[model samples]
Target: MSSPSSTPAAPAVDRLRSWLQGRDLAVFHSVANRHWPGADPLLPQLSRSANHGLLWVGAAAGIAAFGSSARSRRAALRGVASLAVASAAINTVGKSAVRRRRPRVDLVPVVRRLKRQPVTTSFPSGHAASAAAFATGVALESGGWGAVVAPVAAAVAASRVYTGVHYPSDVLAGAALGIGAAFALRGIVPTRGQLPAPGRPPGEAPALPGGEGLVVVVNRASGTAPATASLVREALPLADVVEVAPGGLATALTDAAGRGRALGVCGGDGTVNLAASAAATHGVPLAVFPGGTFNHFAYDLGIETVQETAAALTAGDAIRVDLGRFRPGPNGEDGADGYFLNAFSLGVYPDLVRTREHWSSRIGGWPAGVLAAFHVLRGQRPLEAELQGRRRPLWLLFVGNGLFQRVGPAPGRRHNLADGLLDVRVVHGGRTPALRLLAAAVAGPLTRSPAHAAVRRRRVRIAGLAPGTPYAYDGEVAHSGEELTIDKLPEALTVYCPMPL
Candidate 1:
């Protein structure tokens, strides 16, 4: 009997590694021995600190610590998220599927070696992956902020090769993986700041009588309103633009709604809430021009600047949206009728919002929120209230207008504008309040095993509460006596925006 011999398959990965060594080793060696010495001795030390993307973590933390604008702060948070995705891909999948040896330190100068080299497979550089991921994530939010980090990220990725730990091919693979992770995240998460989504066309919009028939109520007390008011006037020359002080904003919005063919307003979420309520009540379309701090509603509408909203108004791009309505007390007469275009929060949340506002301007929103959480938690006692017919000890409760997607332990943004439901999240602190709250804060609002519960419903009622209990909606706090009934008002308001309602 003659036996046939079959040829074994060649190791393509090994072959590629050899070719990369031949092509890239000389440059890597040159950089290590000669080029890197001219750089600060701290270069490799800095690279070592970047192990597991800790350096990127610190950088994003710093941005969140110092950045005041919601855009920059969100970019920082997204950067950390991207790093998580990229690193998980690299360590758990990318590296495991294709194992490759690290460059031999025999050729690397002692000065260029990492203090503590990675022990994992070196097929793709994890540091490079993290750097690219973080930078791309930031870029996806604000190009200006992304531009600031690009050079640092490029340097960090290059340092992996310069420190004689990875091949150029490894860095290339890592960067590609990182960029892919960022794009993948874009699909998974709800976001604004991307190219504005086209909403309902002009033909779908309700009629606007004329320039005089349209009225815009601008809150002069808003930090950015004075400047924004000029632009609104310039854009809609014949539209009646009224400058109202903050104290009288609600009444002014109601008055403007009564007279105008279409209602427009400028301010923060609180002011917008007033306008949205009026617009919804009067059954008129709303033209929202962002002219306040952290324009949550405007951002959700995909209207970043005043000019964009004004342009949309002129072009007649608009959509119908949801409004969260609640009777703050048993009857409308007992308390002011309440409505929110964003969210409503009770218990420790209102305190945190107020506390965060005190310091968020100086240190930035994320850091301030963190600081405020700690402060609020220390002073906070559970609010005993009836939730959906059950009596429970609740640390905090949030109800959003539409179905909101969770980011960490809280709702970040809504997936739909008029889903005819309220997104309800309740936090239960249990016996160890701090530990439970912190865990719940990070584990995510919708996780199955979470200390909190997230659900969607058309209505919720709370009874047996103390008189004039304070709650927050649209970033402003108010008192509601005894019982409250929160309900979803689907497509209750028409909003002019770039995004679909």
Candidate 2:
């Protein structure tokens, strides 16, 4: 005897399923028979191009190549990643879970039907899923790019039904799954827009309409400088832009800061560091343009493009951020100093930077970094430094201007640029430098492991350095004295940034 619960629901469920299938077939037939003007030749080729995600791949490559900004690269990467997830899901589970057959194409026009039909079960259309995933992912990162891709994605989904390879229900289900995949990926690795703006206090600065009072100093040697500088000119036509050659950054920045209502800088972290120092000393608001291979300071500030910074400048949106300093220099309290806008590090990092800089112009930045890492890890010895009153052997000592948080595996950003704390991280002395560094990277910020430890402090002092021991700060390597102190200047620098929505 069948239980009441099981017997009653089985027939009802079967009836609903039959009803849905009939409706699905009706829609599929309607789409197949309908005449779509100009869709016959265009859609079939578009559908064919999207086979195995080749079209999306090509689109992503194009976006990355032409977009020429960090946001574009990120959008392309996110789109591809979302596509991968959606494709895997459709192949592994979605297709097999519901074995719905493809629709009959007799009603479909001969020219509209695909030459080669899909053979897989069609409960969820993989093409629709991939298209939705890629477009949704791109949109999540960049609205403009997403707007451009969404129509193509919708057309691809429509083509599945127009060609009679998938029912409307199949396409709908697949697109839903694809969108879900994009959101899931966003949850795993959030888009920059999702992150909160740096919790920094706002500062007062002049609203430069068309950047009338802003003076921008461009580092000619920095990555994409010419292109970005040209963008700056186009974006802020009234602003005075000074392009400085190598070894003349100090004079140019000093002069720019002294004269302008606000000082703007375009370059890498190292160049930004000099600008930040000049701005702070001259008591002027600073604007940053990301014209570098790695614009760590600018990206952390959420100023990814010249347009963003220009917008901030036009509106006078500014905030106070902490400045990192190491003491005992040519002049100042505690004997003058040098400043680092991003981080200060000792041990293998300095050597790696030196080596990478040496070879970067020759072999390219990424490969040079890899080669530097290999050379430094293989040849460099652990640093012997006195920290917190005790002498110890260490592989690295990193001190950041503020507390840095782990985005995924390594420390990627800081949420509070004005926080009066130094993020101090260290990897203990070890035999295999590569393993220790890798372990530290995997360990992440504020987490301690057997190989590495991280802590936050108002001040950090390291001693017992050998004469002319190389240390790196903000991608610039230099020699240091026997003892060095790292500290923060709370809200000492004012920088322009777009206010978070």
Candidate 3:
């Protein structure tokens, strides 16, 4: 049934296949006969520990928990994601495609062989794929972590051959596939280093070597503030650190800003906002130590840990960032004047924040937020307010200090903190509040619809608000008056942040 050309190719293909199989078997026997003193007991146990990807999951958890920087957490998450992709491919496609039998363990030493052998195909090693995928993914995000993980991944791959469960060619193929999966994921979702850094418009600040003439005021009530503040103190032994209770933030921030050459804040966004205002008033550069539940401003500045801030202080690295402020107009005086380093919002979000804070102590932060969102959406009505000059019902209104751009499927991130524009987003009042919000979230930063609208402006005026309406800025909720004029002070504040490479 074969043609003349096909008949000639068939024999050549068969001969090549036989040669590769013979070489694979020869290498398998060579590895089985080899003996390493400590590897006898350790290889089998290490190979067993990687079963079902449990070892990689534990390693990712350790990296996330012990590593202090945002890069560490991101690297761990990416590693797990890559491992999942590699494992899925190996199990679903690779094994089924090639029904290769397991290598014979007759030549392998009894002490090196696994007590419970695997029943899967031997053409591709799942353990090697997972280990390589995890290590490569981590290294893509953080080279230091990659260096720490590569040796363990190599050992796991070698163990598969030593145990006689997989041939050397199978392990190599799986590792190649694993590395490919990591790069594929990177193509879909680029790492932070791949994106443009946020800090821009470099500003001058004092070079406080050994933390001389620096003071940090930490909010004790903020999440992990006390412990991280202790780390900051140890890292900057010469700097003055003031740990304050919830009620004492204003006084402590004022005192520290007044005396220190450079003011430092260790807490959440709300605490950072206070420090920024104080620093601006007293004319000093601000150093931020992220010890809060969500350090939005600090993370945006690319300074996630005290050590990074300390390094920046020593090197006098800093940038100029705009400050968002809302106040009453010249003729109006009822609205309170305040500044926000992150964002300001009204309507559903403010109510949600207030409700969440009310029940956060009883339950947990995440649980309370979920409960608050459900309760607010179910019972809350649309906020009737005047946007610019038109009166309309709105579900929510958000104003950011700088332009926010979406990265992949995640929330918006600011690449240029000194862009000098306010990102204004409004969700029009509709029948279903929950559906409107969900649609806005999915629409991303550039949203324009009957239900939602997004724009960038230098200033905005919202009037005709009902008295005592709740407003939130940087996670802190408070009451607002009938009208507010939101504007930006371009390049108003100088803060310590590392320059992008």
C-alpha local distance difference test of each model? 0.77, 0.89, 0.88
Which structure among the candidates has the greatest TM-score?
A: 2
**Deviation (Å) of 260 in candidate 2:** 2.2
Estimate, for each residue in 1-501, the C-alpha lDDT of model 2 and write its tens digit.
Answer: 877778767999999999998998898777776788899999999999999999999999899877867788889999999999999999999999999788876778899888898889988999999999999999999999999999999999988888888889999999999999999999998888887777769998889979899999999998787789999999999999999896999999999999999999998889999999999999999999998878988888888888999999999899999999998522224456899988999989999999999998786666799999998898678999998778999999999889887665678889999889999999999888899898888777787977899889988878788879989999998888778878888999999999887
The best candidate by lDDT is: 2
- The 10-residue segment of model 3 with minimum total lDDT is 328-337
Worst 10 residues of 2 by lDDT: 327-336
Candidate 1 structure quality by residue, lDDT tens digits, 1-501:
533543243467678867877877676666667664455476676677787678888888777655535677778988889989998988789988888888887667777777677787888888888989999998888787899889888888888887788877789899999999988887776345443443332325543423446799999976467788888888778789999998999899999999877889987788898898888888778889887777877876667776777666665667877778888654434556678988898888888889988986687555787899889888568888999789888887888887665544554556567778887878775666677666655655455444677777788888888887789998888876789989866677887765353
Which scores better on lDDT, 2 or 3?
2
Displacement of the residue 363 alpha carbon in candidate 2, Å: 7.7
- Candidate 3 wrongly placed segments (more than 4 Å): 1-20, 35-45, 105-120, 328-332, 351-382, 430-435
Ranked by TM-score, top first:
2, 3, 1
Give the runs in model 1 whose Cα sits over 4 Å from its true position: 1-20, 26-71, 85-126, 141-148, 159-166, 180-245, 251-261, 281-283, 291-293, 328-336, 386-393, 407-409, 424-430, 433-459, 488-490, 499-501
Better of 1 and 2 by TM-score: 2
Model 2 TM-score is: 0.88
